[model samples]
Structures are given as structure tokens and as C-alpha cells.
Target chain A: MSQPSHSSVLPQTELTRHRRLREQGSFRRADLDAILDAGFVCHLGVIVEGRPLVVPTVYGRDERVLYVHGSVASRSMAGGTPVCVTVTQVDGLVLARSVFEHGVNYRSAVIHGTVRKVTDPDEKLEGLRRLTEHATPGQWSYARQPNRKELAATTLLALSLEEASVKIRTGAPDDGDGPDADLGVWAGTLPLTATWGAPEPDPLLPPDIPVPAHIARREGTRHG
Target chain B: MSQPSHSSVLPQTELTRHRRLREQGSFRRADLDAILDAGFVCHLGVIVEGRPLVVPTVYGRDERVLYVHGSVASRSMAGGTPVCVTVTQVDGLVLARSVFEHGVNYRSAVIHGTVRKVTDPDEKLEGLRRLTEHATPGQWSYARQPNRKELAATTLLALSLEEASVKIRTGAPDDGDGPDADLGVWAGTLPLTATWGAPEPDPLLPPDIPVPAHIARREGTRHG
Candidate 1:
């Protein structure tokens, strides 16, 4: 028998195994990267005082690591903590004939890792820059970079991308051939899209300054 | 001294307490309701085998309960499990003159509660109806409802909405008067909006079937 393809496949460990709906799970490393690249915001889950706490945080990722930033005073940004970060993008609604077959067309990636707080000055700055540029491309050079004092007050957590799971569902819903098909109810997919709108200048900003090329061009562009 | 308004405010519990970013926290019951109503998807954080697991799932909420459904075999949907569910809607990006001052304008709600599995057939059906309708109004009535066997294969977890926290950030970015303001780089808010696009009928659907009023009317309407 030919050897199973492992060149570009993500390693499946106990944490990354798909326990349910295995059909939706993807083992390709490219799938994980695509899911992470499509969104800049992720919900971070960490155990706080023996209970789970989910926080909505902004994130940026490189090929090897996912970077999340927060205020130094934030409780969840501590280093060496095991955390789960999930980024989800809703593509549309799967309008099946039956409620049981109805589902969401979405792409999501879940990452499991221990976060390491960046204390080194250079990596911290670079991590922060990636975080900024991830959310708004071309933003790092456009905005003022963080200074020592400003950087001191911020915490950057770097999570490895090795342990990750990707699940994507698209197209029409199930039940077209199922028993519910006899019901004759309408069935289809309703596409949902997030777009960036025109930039509203800061009220205090001087009118002479025009919207930047990077920011202005993003109008009507897809986000998440 | 006059008593602080307590009638409309959510009870402050240890889990709902906002330790950091006090300015973004809200105790108002109406705020929590509004945030929950604005989105149908939530990130559910649950402790699985001593490690935090975050899953992106669809959710629906009533005044006192938030319902989440999944296959009965799903591990995180087990009853008596303590879970944290967070719903977030990104409104805009705050482009500050300084990277340190940059932020996201968003509204989010975090809920902490023990999930109760719905066993009563009536309540289970009702919960499923709410879940369907939450994602698509009039969907429950228009689509074929679940039968007895289908309900048996599904799990519905009901979470109490009594303990929750709300945070909303809007408007222009900070740094208007900060040292970075003098840098003269442009700063503003780029609004992000999610809208429903035209429905695409299932390829297997009969050509005579037209998009229903309930689904077609939502085209071009703002979602989250």
C-alpha cells in the first residue's frame, strides 16, 4: 500500500482529533492557515480560578505562531497559561427543509497551546506590529510605532500554531434527498458577508488630511 | 445619600465582575439583552479534560436562558458543565495616531452558568424553535420541524442569563490630545458591517420555487 500523505498534513494529536462530525474536519495545514488568515479577531478561552473564561481579543499569526496583545493589567494575558483560541467566520446560513439538517456555512479554526509572554524588546515590538497589521494591513508603517514606555504597559502572548483544528462547511444544506424533501418547503443558502464601510475621520482631525490609500481602499472589502 | 439605581441593573456576582477595563463594562440588563439579540453565534468555552476548549456555536437567548444545540454525542454539550459563552459584534476599527492607543469598537456579552440539558419534550421543542428562529426569523414555522427521532439525536443546553457581563466600545480613537496626536498621521474609525446577500436556491430545488418573503426581504439588511 502507498504511504499516506503526510508532507503537508497537520499532525493529529489527541487534542486535535475530531470526535464528532468528522466529515467537516480538515487535516491539511493549509486549511488551518487559511482559516486563521481570514479573520483578525479570535475568542480566547482560558481557565480562570478553575472556571472557563472566554474573551474576545484581536489576534495576528505568522506561520509558526499566533500573537495576541492586551493591556499589561489584563488578567488573561499572563504567560505560560494553557489557552484555546478560536477564530470563526460565518459565510452563510444553510436553509435545509428540516430543522435537524439546518446548519451554518462557516469556517473556524481552534488552536490549543500554552502562551509565552514576550519580554524581549524586539520580539514584543514585532509581535505588536504583526497584531496591528493583521487587523488593518499597511497599518504598522502608517501609525506611530509603540515606544518603550508604551510597550511596557502592553502584554503580548505568543501561541504556537502546531496544535490546531480546522472545520469548514459551505454550500446548500442537507435533506434534499432525505424524508423531509417531501415537505416541499423552500430550501437554499442565505449568504452573509461583512464589509468595511467608508472611514469616518476623527472629529478633531484636520479636514486637510485625506483618508489614507490603505484605509480608503478597504471600503466594501470583505472582513472576516 | 440617594440609592444607586438597582432595578434595571444586573446583579454583580463574582463571575460577572469586571476587574479590568472598568470603563467598558456595563451592568445594565438592557445592554446584555441587546448584545445577545444582535448576534446568533457565540463562542462557548468549556473545560474538557482539564483543558479549556473553545467552540464556535449558534446560540439563542430568552430573558433568563441561553440555548445552545448540538449532536447528543458532542462532549461539550454535557449537562451540569460550567461554560462561558461570549457574543461579540465588531462595529469599527479605532485608528489612533499611536499604536498603543489603537482599539476595536465592539459590543460583547460574556455569560457564566451551568448548562442544563433539556429533557422535557415540550421544552426541548420550544428551545429548538427558539434556536431556529434566532438565526432566521420565521424559519421554524416555514421549515419542517424536527420529529421525535431527530430530537432524540440532538442535545440542547440551556444556560442561565442571570450572571453576565457587557462591554461596548464606540466612537473615535483615543490619542486626540496625547503626545502621538502631534505626529499628524491620519486617524479615524472604519465601520464594519455584516449584511445578508440574496439567497441562492438549492440546486436540487424546483425551479418553480421562489424565495419566500421572509428570506428575500432580509437581503441587503444589516446582520450583526
Candidate 2:
């Protein structure tokens, strides 16, 4: 077997061991990276002044760390604090005949680490570029870079993905072994999906700017 | 004008305020309810043993409080615990010409409150019904309720929506007024939407089991 890369981006947590519903949890490093790359937003959980905070923030990732940005004054990102970031995509609703067996099929990752403030000018610029491209591919090269003043007002933090785990659930609910099997009730999953809709151009466009192929082709495609 | 009901949930701390882009912050009570009603899954943020934990859990709502449940063995539903619940829906992407101005147009509601264990037998039954309907509308009344043994192994918590805030952002990006506009870069919102697709019946479902109107009509509808 090929050895896994010992990168900080890889999940290396003890609790990450697949337990209850063992088949649902995976240890593939590629799985975590793929999920993070396909998604742009995450809920960053942190204790701010001793209060638990789970704020949704835009994020990007390099090979080693996940970067999240906010306003310089954001209480959630200020002071180079420690935080736990979780990115989740609900794949489907596991509907069982019995309420006790009802569950959801999902893909989720939880990262635990300190979000050190990215103060170096070069890293900050690169961080912003990663964030922009993460949201809309090729948009970074298309748009003007932020000036010094804008950069100064922004706060970016890089959190290692080392202490993380990926938990996934799929297929139907496990209602077979229980008495629920004979309940005469309907049981299965309603596959929940997120897809890209038709691209609506800016109303004020000179009417000459054609939609980029990358953006246009994404229309109606399933995301995550 | 008739005064709106103060039944609106209120924001408690500065951290909960719409600080970065104050204009997007919505204080209207209806906004809170609408966001909550539009979502069935919420990320519950709580501290366990001084370490923060963020768990995505399904929730049901009534006139005054939200109910969450899980296996009685779930560490997430410990009673008398303080937790913050957040429900977010990403409606669109604000893809401004300038990367600094790009953002996600989203509607999110955050509730900060303590979770109380429900002991009353009747309320537990009602809570289970609400949760069932929350996941699969019309199925609660159609399916068999949980038996006594199942109830003994389930945990339920009630969290008041008394202290909460709704934050929303919509429309195009704020790149129209900057020097970035002179770069002649395309700028506008790339709307992202989530909708329900055609319902696929359970393969094991009897071929004669006609899809109920409530479930069937949800085909191609927007998810709440």
C-alpha cells in the first residue's frame, strides 16, 4: 500500500476512528480535500471570550492549510485565535418507516487548530487570491487586485487541517434488523442535492460580455 | 400601522450583530421566522468539557421553541446544556468585479439559548411528531409513532428562540463605485439556488403504493 502524505492538510485525529456506523466514516485524505475544494463556505467554531461561536465564513485552501478571511475588526477572527472549522454538505434525508431510525446522509469535516493571523504582505495577497479563485475560478486574474488599504482592513487566518476528520453517511436508513421492517410504513431516502442554476448576467453589462465557458457550463450542474 | 408582534427574536451580544456589513443585518421578526422555517438542519454549537463542539442536527419548531433529538446516547443532546443554533441558506453568490467585494448572498438565523430536557410524556410524543413532520412533511401522521422501547432510547431538548438574530445579504456586489470598475471587468451576482427534485419512490415500496399528494407535489419545488 502507498503511504499517505504526512501533510498538515491531512486529518490526523484519534476520535476520527470509524465507530458507530463504521462504513459511513472514511479516512481517505483525498476525500477531505475534494470536499473542501468543491465548497466555498464553512462554519468556523471558536470560543470568543469564553462564548462558543460558530460563524459562517468564506474560506480557501492551499496544500497545507485552510485560510478564512473576515473584516479586520471581526470578533470571530481577531487576535489570531484558536478555532474549529466545520464544512458540511447534506447529501440526502434518510427517511425510515420508524422515526427512531430516521437520519440524514451527509459529508462533513471538522478541523481543530489555531487560526494564526496572516500578517505577511505577500501571504495576505496570495491568501486573497486563493479565496477569490475558490469562489469563482479564473475571477482573480480577471479582476483588479486589492490595494494596500483594503488589505490592511482585512483579516485572514490560516488553520492547519491536521487535526480533522471526515464523516460521511449514505444509502438508506438501517431499519432492517428492527421490528420497523414490518411496519407497513414507507421507508427510504429523499436525496437532497445542490445544483447550479442558469447564470444570470449583470443587468448593466454592455451586452457584449459573453458568459465565460467555465461559468456558463456550470449551469444546472450538481455541486458537492 | 399595526405594530408588528414583538414575538420577533432578539439579538443578545455584539458578536451576534451584523457588524461587517451592517446594511445586510435584518432585525425584523419575520426575517428570523422565515429563515428558520426555510431550514430543517441546524448547526448546534456547544462546549463539551471546555472544548467547543459543532454538530449538525435536525430540528423542529413550534410557536415558541425549537426541538432537537438524537439517540439517548448522543453526547450532543445532553440536557440543561447551553448551545447556539444557526440555520443558514445560501441564496446566491455576490461575484463583484473586485475580489475584495465578492461575498455570498445568504440568509442566516442564529439562536443563542440553553437546551432543556423535556420529561413530560405527552410533550415527548408531540416533539417526536413535530420532528418527523419537519423532516418528511405529512409522513408524521401517515407513519407509526415510536413505540415505548424506542422512546426510552431517544433524547430531546427544547431551545427557546427568544434570543436570536437574522442576518441577510442580497443583490449585486459593492464593486460599482470603486476604481475596479474602470478595469472593465465583468461584475454582478451569480445566483445559487437549492430546489427539490422529482421524488423517487423507494424501490421496496409496493408498486401500488401511490405517491401521496403532499410528497409528490414537492417535486421540483424549492426546499424550505
Candidate 3:
């Protein structure tokens, strides 16, 4: 598969700089896109009434803009608020000979930006299409498009991906050459994999209707 | 399995109350413990210099206290700061006949509290043990424990689980009886499941060494 287009490197602001694990951090914009594309759900962090609130929401990305949608009355959907959108995929558990070295193998991206509401009618529809297609491919074209009333009820916020941080940790544990390696304990990585199981048809659907090809093909396929 | 001891229901504080989708919210303390116990990774949300930052980390819980550990120098690990820790598990994709109704079936917990540093040596040791066992059961006793020097390098914070918000969305899409049902489009849930694969041994390990029974038995087992 062709890689997503990311022409420039991610700009590291004072907030995006890695303070702890500098080696695991990356400035490559491609890494950010890969991390974002590998998952659909993200945790949105916003300050509400002077306290931080982290909410789980589904998101989509088109080039440099990441789109998140919610109800119009949702507090986190308020436009122009500074938000932190984080997407993480846990790949495995790194079993080490020492408890101190045990860690998770994962990839994560943190995007820090002020969210802008999509007020334009055309952009709003297109943003919604991206959001739907991001979660389930081919559904945007196969399903019924939104009407004016549905469009007005939803709130879509766009966040720039320019200021983002990507960190990835993989491979075996770091204690292979340490003192714990001599302890005769088993040490390796127990990989974790997620896959799509058989699609369960809606109980209320007519028995004559069959599952769509787009949805059927995803069965047994790997997910982030 | 016996349920964890929870004395009372979670207090519905001003912050924990669900402003939107109130029907999906729950104040039951048992629900909070179940959500926390099912996952090991969480997104830590904190304000650093007035900007919201979300970091992914591992956590453990002991009755009313949830412990999270990180490097002492990590900026987001600062003690005594008001923080939000969120744990989410995506069960499936809720595919609807209408693009407007597309949603994800998930269970998530948002914890809001001021984190206190575990300064006492005995408590610190116990906290670390809980964290280790939480992530990898049976490994705590199999592997070498952290030394005093290692403990000094780590920073552990305890957050009370008294104030938390639990929201769960499950089953099929809500548009089964709506107008979109006449469109002859597929509508159902594509279940997602994570499982543990075979353990990969370190390349430099002795050939005679075998995978431990605890880790070996977990292969092919389902994960949250």
C-alpha cells in the first residue's frame, strides 16, 4: 500500500518536545499520519470549568486536518478551545526478566491545537464523509447521505496536525544484557493482535436482505 | 469471579455528571471497578503551562486508590496536580444504514482527581508491585523485584477512584427502525477482539530456556 502524503516534518513546539523518552520520539510527519490512520478512536483532552476532562471520541484525518464530531451541546465540541487529541495502539506486552523493565509496545500520537468548527456547508458535509469513511470504509457511498436537518444537529471540529508528537516503542525488552538476564527467567514479547470477527446482522432486518460486500470483506481482517 | 469490594456508589460530582448522552452514564461503583480492571493502559490528561497534554501510561488499582507510575523527570507525572485519567475499550463498530448514525460500541471511564505522590517507601514498593501484577499477572513473582535505586528513579502517584464517570455503548446501531431502514443497506456490528499471540523469545537467550508456564498458557487467550 502507498504511504500517506506528508510533505513536511512536524513542528516541535515547547509543548510537543519530548521531556522523558527522547529516543522514542519522532518528528517525521509520516509517523504521525501512520499513527493516526492506524486507529479511529482518540481521547480528547480539554479543560472544562478549570478541570481537565479526557473524552473518548472517533476522529478522521484529511492531510493536515483531523476532524472530530459530537453533539452540538457537547462541552468538548466547543470551537476555539485548546484541545489535546491522543491516539494510541497497544501492540504487545514486553515481558522482561526484571519487573522494572516490563513495558508495553505501542505507537501513539498527540496533537495539540485549538479546534475550529466547520461552519461552511460544503466542508461540513465533506468532513462528515471523512469521519464515516475513516471508521468503516465504503459506508459513505453505500449508506444514505445526511440530510439538512441531520447536518445541523451535528458539530464538526477541525484540528491542525502541524503541532503533534509521535512516540513508538517496539521490539524486545531492554534488559537482555542487564543483570536480570542471568536470572533464568523467561523474557520476550507476547504480541497482541485485534481482528474483525463475523459481522452480525441486525435482528430487525429482513431475512431476504444479505450482508453488503464492503462489510463482508472485512471479516477476519486485521485492525489496529 | 467475585466482584471487587465497593462500599458505595460513585459520587456524582459536578465534574463527573454526564452533560450529554446522560442515558449511557452510570454512577454504580461496580461498573467503575469493572472498567478499570479490564484494561491496563490509560490516557493521562494534565495541564502543563496552561495547555492540555495527554500521555499514555500503565496503571493499577487497589480498592479505592488507583496508582500510576512514570519517570520522576516526566513533566506530566508531577504530583499533587489535578488530572484526568481515561481508560477506554472499543468493542466494535456500529454500522448504520445512515451515515449520520455511525457510532462505536465502547466502554470508557473518566477519572478526575488530584494525584498524590507515594512517598513512603513501603507504600511505594507495594504500589509498584500492584502496577506490575496488574499489567502482567504471575510475572511479579517470577521476575526480579525493583531495587532501591530503581525505586528511587520512579515516581508513583495515587488517585482516589471515588470520583469517576462511566459510559458504555453497546449492541447494534440505533437507526434500525428509522427511515434509513428502507434504503436496503446493511446495518450491523462488526465485533472486534484482541488476543495474545505466541511469545517470541529473545534472540540471545540460551536455547535450553523455555517459555514459562504462566506466559505460555496465555497464548491465544482473549484480551480486553
Candidate 4:
């Protein structure tokens, strides 16, 4: 299937449209970009041998494509497969009076496309570069670049960001105004925060080397 | 597919078998239990029409079955569909000297089974209770229980935990003994920690209501 949307807002397709909970859906392309940027790891779902397989893998994205790499033999890394890449940032739990009304405060984006195996040497380099920089910025230049053999063993799959769905749920529980409010059960949100901790130096590292500024700055920072 | 394994280790079914990175795979059933217990949210993958769809949803599990609830109308909530439920907890980013060796320290469990819809009301209530308690302990007792109407609108799917593949990656990168270690670029792990923050009371909550002790206890505690 071809996705050819040029509008600023993501064009709705049968795959990207929200059939239920329409209010939680977003048509804005920027919202999709933000959700993708907030997390480096994503759950990639693909059909393997007539069965659905979901794997967690680190990813990087450019203006229009999401790049993920894995070992060449992995099921999710197969080229030309229709893949659903989902990135979710769970912000908190909405503790409502009723268990039925409870919800999770989160930002999630699902992108659907036929993954194209990156083959061009220059494009593959760029994709791998984006993948490294996406997870740990400035480390691309600091780390040794992938040599030809390393690149060959790695499979980088690129999926277009053209067809995507973005959903962000924030704030209080949905049962605040409902009849359950009279139950007097304590209800609110317990926010969840992901933070980067201090860098643990590799045991084999020589003592003379210090944590780089870029890596050091990430400590204690919000991850998603 | 019939999964009738009685051993402490998960049976190596065609679906659960690991093709690559054989060293990272774990066959122990207890390992799968630990991975599932570490996280409440899971990425549920199912084939809709013909393409793959991955959704992030809250989940709970018991000794034999894993439970997840969603709106009855969701594509991922369909009954008797072959599904892949994957739960992953990212511990840290493994930064190595070469970009090619970069990896994620994570614990993940992937289960494949045909989902069974809860038609019995008693099992439905128990499943919902387990789900609520999974995300927030003591929540089911503190919150208002689900009524008939709410239960009808919800769909609970049960997948057997018997067929699962567990993989846990910990410690430093694998390139320490490789040639890239001579590059002199600092390499180690930047740990990721998920913690519960101070509860944000709902704006509509009565001022006299205090935060529940169970909820308060989670604050400043490690999650996943």
C-alpha cells in the first residue's frame, strides 16, 4: 500500500483511523513526531510464518522514516514485511473510584508500513547513524563507526511515518463527574517518571577515561 | 496450537524457539514469571484483516493465564484470535566502543496463544481484579468494583503463560574482548530507572480526601 500524504496533519487511512475512543486520537503529524522522539525503544509487530511476533528494539527516526536495526536473522527485521511499530510512554496511572473507569496516562504512537530493508551503503550508514544518535546523542561521533562487515551483519529496516496514529492521555481520572464520585474512595493519579541514572563504567575500562559530557548530562534527566 | 508442557522450563515449541542470539534466551518458567511480574503494561499484537497491529494495554496474570482488558470493540480485543502478548522492561542502554555493538539491557517475555474471551461473569470479575491489583496493589479493594453494565462493555482476553519465551540482557556490552575495545572510547551502561512520583490529586477530588497509604507507599519506589 502506498501512503502519499503531503498535508501537515497526518492523513487518515483505514489503518491509522481511530475506530473507538476518537477523542484520544490525533491527526497532527507533530504529535506523532513528539511521541517517536520521546523514546528510543519501540515494540515492532510483524507477521512471521502466519503468526504475529512482537519484539522490543531500539529505533531512530528521520523526517519521514523510522529506522530500526537488529540481527539479520531476527523475525522482526525481515525486509518487505508489513510492520506495526508502536512507541508508548506510560506517564502515570489514573486511579479512578471504579476499576472500570481507571486508565493509564500515556503517550503512544503506532505507525504502519511495509518495512524496506536499507541496502544502499550510504543510506545504510545514514540510517545506522540516526539509530545511534537517536538513543545516545553525540555517541555516534565518539564511538567507532560500523565497518563493512559489521554493517553487513546488521539489518536496518525503514518504515515510513506517513501513516501513523498518536494518542496522549493526561490528567485526572474519567470518573470524577460520574456517580462513582460519591463512593468516597480516594482517587487520583500516581504519575510514573522514567529517569536516567548515573553511568556505570564498564569493568574493563581503563581508569583514566572519564564519562563524556554528553553522556554525563543525561544523568537524572527525564527519559520519556 | 496445544501447549502442554509440565516441566519447569518452558517447552521449545516452534513459536517459542529462539533463532538467533541463542545465548540470551531463557527456558526457565520462573524467568518468564519474573519478567511478567516486573511490568503491568504489554504490547499486544494481533492481525487485523491481514496486517499486524500492536497496542499497548494494561495486563495482569496468575499462575497459568495472563489477563488483559480493553473495550469490546478494539481490533486487538477480538475473541479467539491468535495473538502475541509481549512485555518488556528496559533496564539501560549498553553503550559499547563501536556503534555496531550497542545494545539494550532488558527483560522481555513473549507469549503466543489464541485468546479466550471471558464469557463467565465470575471469571471476568476475577480477571479484572487481578488487572487492577497488578498495576496498583490493593487497588481493587480500595476502588469501587465493576458493575454489570461496565463489565459488559469491557472485553477480557486470557492467554496461557505456558507458551512463552524469556530473554534477559544484563551487565556490560559484549565488545570488551573485541578489537573495538582498543579504540579508547569510553563504554558502559547508562541505567534507566522508572519510579513513581508524588500522586497528583484529581482537580475534582474533595479536599478532605487523603491519599491512600498504598498509593503513597509507591512514591519514590522503583517500578519495573
Predicted candidate 4 versus true structure: per-residue lDDT over B125-222, tens digit per residue: 99999999999999999998899998888888888887898888999988888877787889999999999999989899998999999999999999
lDDT of 3 by residue, A118-151 (tens): 9888999999999988988888999888899989
Recovered native contacts, candidate 4: 0.88
**Stretches of candidate 4 above 4 Å error?**
A1-6, A71-79, B1-6, B71-78
Model 4, residue B85: distance off in Å is 0.4
Give residue A202's lDDT in candidate 4 (0 to 100). Answer: 94
lDDT (Cα, tens digit) per residue for candidate 1, span A1-224: 11344336777999888888788999888888888888878998889888888989898877788998763224754677889999999998999998888899999899999888888999999999889999999999999898999888888889998888888898987788777777778899999999999999999888888889999999989887
lDDT (tens digit, per residue) of candidate 3 on B37-59 = 88899998888777778889999
Residue range B111-147, candidate 2, lDDT tens digits: 8777887778788889888887887789877766788
- Worst lDDT run of 10 residues, candidate 4 chain B, spans B70-79
C-alpha lDDT of residue A153 in model 3: 82
Candidate 1 Cα outliers beyond 4 Å, as residue runs: A1-7, A71-78, B1-7, B71-77
Better of 2 and 3 by TM-score: 3
Write the residue-wise lDDT of candidate 1 on B1-224 in tens digits: 11343346888998888888788999998898899988988998888888889898888866688998753124655678888899999998999998888999999999998888899989899999999999999999899898999898888889988889898899998788777777888999999999999999988888787788999999999998
Those runs of model 3 whose alpha carbons end farther than 4 Å from true positions after fitting are A1-6, A71-77, B1-6, B71-78
Q: What are the clashing pairs of model 2?
A: B38-B224
